[model samples]
Each structure stands twice: as C-alpha cells, then as structure tokens.
Target chain A: MMSFVVGIAGVAVFSVLARVMQSAARGTSPVAILAIAAILSHLASVALGIIYVPQFQYWSAASIFSFGVMSYVFVFGAVYKSVSLEVLLAVAGHPDRAVPLPYIVGHQVPEIFRGRIQILIESGLVEQIGSTFAATAAGERLAARIARLRRMFAIGDSGLYDFPD
Target chain B: MVGLVTPAMNFLPGPAQTAAICLGIALPLLLLCYARIPGIRGAGSRFRIGCATAAALFAIACAVLPGERRIDDVAGGILLLATAMLLVYVFWGLLAWGFTLTLLTTLAQAGRPLTEEQWAAAYTQGGDIGKFARNRLKLLLGSGMVAVTGDTIAATSSGMAIARLARLVRLATGLR
Candidate 1:
C-alpha cells in the first residue's frame, strides 16, 4: 500500500513538474520560479513518504533516495538558472561578454519568429554592425516575410508556424 | 503434526527482494538517460558522457556491495555514505557547468566584442551572470534537498510494499 501511494505521488509530482517546465518555456514564469516550485513539491512528497512509511526510516534507503533527489534537483535548477542568467546578461549589453551571446539571444526569441538580426538587436549583445550585419539584415528580411505570411494566413500567435489549411 | 506458529517479521526486505527493488529504481533512470542523451553534440556530449560514467560506476559499486545490510550496521552505513557522497559530487559538477554556461552566454549578448581577459574579469566580478548564478545555485540547492527527501520516502515506501507482498505470497504458498 505504501508503494502504491508513493507511485501515485511520484506520478503526480512528475506531472506537475512537466507543467511547470512548460510554463517556464512559455515565459509564464521565470525559470528560477519554476525550479523553486519543483523543489518544493519534491520535498513535500519526501516528507509525506517518510511520515507514512517506516521502512524508509533506515539510513541506507533514506541516504540513497536523498542523494538521488538532490542530484536531479541540483542539475535542473543549475542548468535553468544558468540559462536565464545568461539571457539577462546578454540583454544588459555589458562589455565583458561572459557567455555565447548568439545562443543566448536565439533562446530569447520565439522559435518561429527567431532570426539572427533580431537576436543581435534585442539581446543587446552585439557591439557593432560587423560582417555579420548582412546575415542579420537577411534574417530581418526573412522574419518580415514570415510575419507577412502569417498575417495573410490569419494565423494566431500559436499557429504562426503552422501550415495554412 | 503442525509446527508452532512464528511471529510475523516485518519492516525488512529479504536479500533477493532488496536487490530487485534497487534494480527497479536504477533501471528506469538508466533508460531515461540513454534516451535523452543521444544526438547531443560537443560540450553537451562531454557532459552526458561524464554523467553516464559516474552513474555507471555508482551502480556497479552498489551492486557489488553486500545486500540485506541494515542501515544500523556500520558496513551498511558506510556504503550509504559513499553513495551519498558520489551523488553530491556529480550534482556539484553539473551545477558548476550550468553556472559557467549562463555566464558565458550573458557576456556574449552584451553587444561588445569582449576579449578573453575582459570576459574573465567580468566573470570574476559580481556581474549579471555571477549574480544570477548565485541566486540560481541557492534555489537549486534548496530544491535538491526537498527532492532528495521526497525520493527517499517514496523509494522506502515502495520497497516496503514489495516486502509485504512477498510475505503474503509466502503465506499463501504455506511456506512459513
């Protein structure tokens, strides 16, 4: 019975995490917020499990479980946190250029409307209109064309990338 | 003649049962890693390979260790400690890498062609990346604590359930 409960709870926890991740992806909340939520939920589950199950009282089981959970949580939180920070840095137009500005900028834009030109401008990472300026210009033109196509097809924001029926 | 009835033994998994439970836990994780890691290139590949190797080594160590050892026993406690240490080590490495990535990306976006020296200085200073990484690390570490506690509870409950089910089966078969 304890196992069944744990299984059910595990499923629930993962489901909530998936939703949280999706929300983060959609820019509903910052990645940091999502990480916090995931961590809290996981902790809650662990507490509940310990309270209800005696076998977990053993040090070995508890230790292994703790380590596994910690590892996963740390990895997820760190990765997302790092990515978000990079985005902020790129946007600030700093001189140091700590991260790969292009990748950071690319992530900021929505996938369908993304382009090198917009990324460079919006991210504020690029210092000058160098040789890559042409590529940026081309990307801008492409984006404009795509936007025009979307308007012509009456596509919604979500449907911008979809083929016209 | 019937033998004397024995008191029920509860709360511990038999050797075979414990092995099965551990394997169940490890197998899914391995499969998940395998599925998600392929097709990643470059630095990502290196990270994946490192994680995989660590996981593999840990799993092997766990397998080779004696089974059915009680946590209260010194040997069991030592094994558990070792496992915990390894897990922490792997997690820390991931966190460091993640922070590094975030820092690099942010600098790149700053619109200035930064020399490596400039980048290094910015990284060392409490620049945006540094600040963000600090905040993120705290959040991740906190969340990790929660996750670890929850997983331990869940795994223990599951293992207990398996032991109970086995007990029931033994009774049904009139083995005890």
Candidate 2:
C-alpha cells in the first residue's frame, strides 16, 4: 500500500514536472522532457520509499509506477502524432461537422504530409534540397535498422491500416 | 500517517514478480520465434500470439509457484506484465507503422532527390498521396467514427466524442 502510494506520487510529480519543463523550454523534445521527469521522479519515489517504508519492495513499486508512466507516454504519442485522429478532429471541428472529399485529399492530407516532412527536417533525418528532399546518412542508417526490423517481423512499409475486405 | 511508517510491510511480491519478469523477457523472444514460423502471416497476428503465449505462461507460473499468492503480489505481477506489453507495442508500432519513419525509409531507398509529389508517390509504391489518404480514411470509416456521403465526409457522434477526448489528452499531456 505504501509502495502504491509512492508510485502514484511519482506519477503526479512526473506530470507536474513535465508540464513545467515543456512550458519553460519549447525547443526541447517533449518526449525527452517527459522521460527525464519520469526517471527523476521514479528515483525520488524509490529513495523516499527506502528511507520511510519498512521492508520496501522495489519491484512492486517499480512495476506500478512504470505502468503509469508508460501508459501516459502511449496516450501522449497517440494524441500527438496519429494522422487518423487528426482527420477525425478536423471533421469534428469543422462548422458543419463535414468536409468535402477533395478538401481532405487535396488540402488536409498534403498539409499533414508537409508537416511530417518538416519534422524530419527538424530532426536532421531528411534534408531539403532545392525543390527536392533526400535522407541523410544518419537517416539512412536508422531507416535500414527499421527496415530490418520490419522485414524480421514481416511487416509492410506502407504504414497503412489493413482493412479486411 | 501510520500507514506511511508501517513496519514489516511484507508487500514484497517476490515469486509472482519474478515470474512476470521471466515472461516479460520471453515476449520478444517469442515474437522472434513466431516470425520464423511460416503459419503466422501478419505482424498483428504474430504479436497477438506472442502476447497470448506470454500471458498463458504467466498464469501457469502464478499457479505453480510455491507460495500463497497475496492480492498485492498478483496485482503487481499483472501490472508488470502490462507495462511490458505496452512498451513492446510502442516499439513495434514505431518499427511497423510509423509514418515519419516510413517516409525516411522510402527516401533513403530511393537514392535520389524527390519532389514532394515524387516522395508521396514512392511512399505509396507508385500510387499518389490520395491513395494514402484514402487508406487512412478507411480506418475511420471502418471504425464508424466518420461517414462518407456522396463526395463528402462527416464525423459521427462517436467521432466527435473521440475528438474531444483527444483534445483533452493533448491538453493534459502538454502537447497543445
């Protein structure tokens, strides 16, 4: 019970610290900020538990606390980067709760594509040559690693949802 | 306050947690072994099978481990397994279905500079970006989140609710 309490306290600390760090430094990656906050808070929680709780069970506390932090990161990634959610949000936010197919295919999809490209550029993975783009050497190595994993897993590179016919 | 200082708190969860840790380590190994099998076809199918096998083994371990299982032990065991599952899923998603990663891979494979249109074309294996957009829309349509009517797409009620929820998540996660 004390372990669970400490774990939950760690989650709260992580959340508050993450929000504060992100607000203060917009240039840092949010994932990095959240990860740092999670690690620090978890360590603090474990230290406090060791000092206060008799017979402190490290694994029990770590399990629950890691679960909470991972779940938060999962939801955060989904909300931040899911293109399907973006499409849904776009339609839902429209005045009529609808949009023409052409608007979606032409404008919204292209905007999303460009946005991803910008992310790649910002991350130093892909470089924009005049009127064209190419992956950097580092990007190539990373891509190769991802490709090997996908091949090992028999996953396709399309990144499309497989709808059963 | 007494709860905080309770001596001899025996929530050590030793046996079950050890079992959970064993199963967690076995999960990726199971996935790799499953990949070698010709019967399992899709990545999703293989992953499901791996998780199921791990879960079944964990259940067996819980039953077989020589101790009276406490509630805290069982709960902690379950939490550890769940955390392992989520961590693997995140890594799997990144490797298999990450859009930005795919884009980088496609460009790397192309070995030449590509205009935006060319890159989209390559990404879809010669189909245009519209094909990719339609593929994503298929998920929304299949999930009943959105409906298509004659040339237009509209959000269903569930879609609106999910959108609001996504917004709330973004706000709470400091993404907005």
Candidate 3:
C-alpha cells in the first residue's frame, strides 16, 4: 500500500516535471518528455521505497506506476489532436458558448488539418512536391503498415469517426 | 525483516512465469498474423480477440505449469500481461485511427502530388470538409460535449469541462 501510494505520487511528479522540461526540449514531443519523466520518477520512487520500506515489493510498485503512466499517455493521446474535442473547445471558448458553422468549417477544421499536415511534413512522413504534397517513401511504408493494422482491427482509412453506414 | 527479494516472491514463478513471459512477447506477433487473416473484421474486435487469446493462453500456462500458485508470482504474471496488452493497444490505436498517420496514408495512396482541392477531395474520398467536420461533430454530440440547435452548436456544461481540461493539458504539455 505504501509503495502504491509512492508510485502514484511519482506519476504526479512526472506529469509536472515533464511540463517543466518540455520548454527546454524544443525538438522533443511532449510525449517523449513525459516518457522520460516517467522513467526518472519511477527509478526515484523505487530507490526511495527500498530505503524507506521494510520489505519493498518491486512488482507491485512497478505495476501501478506503469499502469498510471499508460493511463496518462492514453488521455494525452486522446486530446492531443482530437477534432471533436477541438470543436468543443472552440465553442466553449466563445463567450456566447456557441460558434457559427461557417467559422468551424472555414477556420477550425482547416487549422487542425494544416497543423496535422505540418507535423507530417516535419516528421518526413509527407513532403511537398512543387505544386502539391505527397507521401514520402517512409510515409508509404508506414501507411501500408497502418493500413494492414487497421484492416486487422476493422477500422477505415478515412480518419473520420465511424458511424454505421 | 531484511531481504533483497520480497518474501512472497522468494518462491519465484517457475514454469508458469516463463510461459506468461513468452506469451506476452507473442501477443503482438499474433496481432500481426491476425491482421493478415481476411475474415477478421473491425480493429476493435481483432484487438479484443488478441487480448482474450493472450489471457486464455496465460490461464493455460498457470494451470499446466508444474507448480502451485504463489500469490506474488501470480500477481507479477498478471501485471506483466496487463502491461503488454496496454502497450499493444496504445500502438495499435495509433495505427488504426491516428489522424496524422491516416493523412499520410491518404497522400501516399494518392500516388502523386495533389493540388489543395484535389488533396481535399482525395482525403475525404469525395466528401467535403463539412462532412468531415460533421463526422467529428457527431462524436462531440454523442459524447454529450456539444449541443446543436438548428444552425448553431454550443458546448454543454460537460463540454466546458472538457474544454478546460484540454486547455490544462495543452498548457502542461507545452502544446499551447
């Protein structure tokens, strides 16, 4: 129980420390920063437990810590570029708590789409070719694997939310 | 009172632990294989099958392994199994529905550079951006995050909560 509490505290520390270190990691993703923080925090927690506890349970401490970190990552991934959530945020940000469809279609959607594209380009998964953009070789390979996985998992390629067609 | 290994773990896992560890590694390999099977449908269904198969296999390992179960050993095995499942889900979800990844796939599938208009068309497969917008909007509506009244949409109270949370996440992740 004590080790579990310590592990949970370690996750909390990791979240904050990841944020603090994110600015310095200009080239790193927040996910990467968080991962590093998780590692450091877990090690620190384990050491602290060994010194403080009469007989520390390594697996128990590790289990909860890992589960906590994975849950955090899941939440982070969900909100990171969620189009639906972005729309909610936009409407919520408005003083009137309402947003025009035109604004959403014209601005919000494009903003998110472009942002995603920019990331793709930066990561070399996509590239500009004179007048337009195309997937790079790496992108093609990645896309193929993704396509295979999606097929196995019964997902579509559209990236849109699935509604019964 | 003093021990490098916990007393519960002193007995170790024996054969059961070994098999569990082996199955954890094989989980992804199974997913990769099942992906090739045409009969499998739905990424969600396929993943669930993988996890269930893993759990069942682990169960067999526990039942067949030549030892009585120790609580710590069993607990450790369960934790290891759970970790593998979670890790696989994280990566698999990214592959299945990841926005950036799908976009890259779309462009790659296109086989050539597309003009902005062509790109949009290709991306949505003939549906305009509005449809894509509504597709996402539908998610917000389904999740009770946003309400629609005729031509306009407003965030519900829960939506506002989500908004606040998203803001905090963005700020903390330096994604602001």
Candidate 4:
C-alpha cells in the first residue's frame, strides 16, 4: 500500500514537472521550477523507498541519491546552455527568418541598399520578406535563378542554391 | 500477526498482472495519438491497423498468461523489446510534430501563412527556436517520467532487500 502511494506520488511529481517545463518554454522562468521539482521529487522518492523497500539499504540509497543529483545537474546544464544561446541570438538583432540563407540576406540585404524600398520589398526579394505575393514572385525568380545557375555550373540535381530555394 | 501472513499473500498477481496493467494504460494512449495526428492518417491507414493489431495481441497475451513464470520468462521480454521499438517510433513522431507545430505557430504569430517550400525548409533546419523548445519539453517530460519510475522501483527493491536481511539476521541470532 505504501509502495502504491509512492508510485502515485512519483507520477504526479513528474507530470507537474513536465507541465512546468512546457510553461517555461512558453516564456516562463522554468529553470528554478525545474530545480525545485527535481530536488523535491528526488527526496520524496528516497523517503518512500526507505519506507517501503527493504532492499534499498544504505549503499543503494546513496547510489540512487547520487544518480538523481547527477541527472538533475546534467539536465539543468543542457537546458541552460541551449536557452542562453537562443536568447542571445534573439537579442543580437537577427531578423527572424524561418530558414537561414547562406548570405544573411535578411540582415545584410536591408543594409546593402540603405533605404531602397526595404530590399525585402524589392522585386524577387519579397519571398524572403514574409509577404505572400512577394514571396511567390521571389520564389519563382529564385527557382529560375537556381535552375540557371545549376545548369551553367553543370551542377548535379542536388538542389544546391546560393539562397534558400 | 504479520509473521502469520504467507509470502505468497504479499506477492500480487505477478508478471501477467503487471502486463495487463501496462496494456490497459498503453492502448488508450495509442488510440489518442492516432486519432489526433492528421499526418499519420495521410501517410497510411496500414500503420494504424498494424499498431491496433499489435496492441490487441499484447493484451491477449497478458490475459492468457497463467502465472509469473509464463509472463516473466517469455512474454515480458518480448513486450519490453517491442515497447523499445515503439518508443523509437514515437520519438520520431514527436520530433516531426514539434517541428510542424513550431512552424505553424511562428507563421500565425507573424500574421501570415507559409508556403509549402518555406514550411518544408523550416522543418529541415531542425534548429528553429520554437521547435527546439517544444522538443526539449517533450524530452524533459520523458526523462522526468523515467527518473520517477526508476526511483519507485529502486525504493521498493531496497525495502524488500532490507526485510530479507532482517529475517536472515533474526534466524542467525535465534531471536525469531
């Protein structure tokens, strides 16, 4: 009966943790929540193990505790590194393009023409600008250019283009 | 009074019972996944049928297994192996679903509908922040579940070990 109770608690703890992580990704400070959850869950599991499982002696208890700690550390570290990198890139004024182009067109193109119709709004560039009509025209032009370039360079049909095609 | 209770009395229904419990949990989840996922429907009905058949077979096997010996010695191993394979497929499904969700969300946020190629390209990059966020959340949930389940198993096993040792010590000391 105690084991069953512990199992239910374990499931609840993990479920809450999952929801917290999702919330964090949706723009919440999830790291602190994650850390707290990990600690609480680990401790709860250990306490329950001690009560219910006769086999979880001193050595096994120590091992399990250490494993839990290590797992928490690893997960937290990975999340921190990835989230920090994403935040930094976002802050650095990178124009949010769905896909990366080889020439940094979103950033560089606007700078190149200074103030000539936003370059993004220019003919054959609208596709990258996120306007439907412009995107379609730009896409067609890009496809043609890519086909021409590939043929001119005798490139295989690998679909390689200087821009995202 | 506790000593008067037989060992068998504490042992539950064994392997067959455990398998039955898992199947009961898994079947509904599998059905939910199939019903909600449009991409899977478009890909093929065959896959869905195969999964349904597999789930039924597993359920029947669990129900028919008479005791711990039949379930643990044979069926449990096979089930574990199959579960591992299903997990791999689920991982792929999650990744694809995550990518699609991210792309759609971004486009909606930007107040536009993405073209087919753009959508395709976005998914191929595998590094969109929104998509990454979704995938990470899924992984976190998955790992968290494993950790919790493992803890419970470890705790239960430990308690059993301690009880056995106490019994042995009592026997040696002639105190029982």
Better of 1 and 2 by lDDT: 2
Q: B40-151 in candidate 3: lDDT tens per residue? A: 7667778889999999999988887776886655665776677778888878777766767777888888888876567777778897677778788888888898888877
lDDT for every model?
0.39, 0.87, 0.77, 0.38
Listed models, DockQ each: 0.03, 0.67, 0.50, 0.03
Listed for every candidate in order, the interface RMSD values in angstroms are: 21.5, 2.4, 3.7, 22.2
| Decreasing lDDT order of the candidates | 2, 3, 1, 4
The model with the greatest lDDT is: 2
Which one wins by lDDT: 1 or 3? 3
Residue lDDT tens for model 2, A101-128: 9999999999999999999999999999
Error of 1 at B170 (Å): 46
Question: Tens-digit lDDT track for model 4 on B1-176?
Answer: 34232222132334543553455356434544554555443212423454565566666775677653542323333434244335433432322232222233333333444554443344335333333333332332333311123212111233334334544533332223
**Candidate 1 stretches greater than 4 Å from native:** A1-8, A17-30, A57-165, B1-45, B66-176
Off by over 4 Å in 3: A151-155, B1-40, B48-82, B172-174
Query: What lDDT would candidate 4 get against the real structure?
Result: 0.38
Q: Against the native chain B, what TM-score does each candidate's chain B reach?
A: 0.25, 0.91, 0.74, 0.25
Best of the candidates, TM-score: 2
Model 2 residue B2 distance off true place after TM-score fit, in angstroms: 12
Q: Which ranking of candidates, highest TM-score first?
A: 2, 3, 1, 4
Give per-residue CA lDDT, model 3, range A1-165, as digits (tens). 665666677778777777678777878777778878888988887776776665566665666677778777777777777777778888998999999878898789988888888898899888887879988888889888877767655567887656656
Model 4 lDDT, residue B50, Cα: 41
B1-176: candidate 2 lDDT, tens digit per residue: 65466544444557888888878877888898888899987777788899999999989998998979977777888899988988899898877778999999999999999999999999999999999999999989988999999999999999999999999988877778
| Candidate 4 residue spans exceeding 4 A from truth | A15-43, A52-165, B1-13, B17-47, B68-92, B95-176
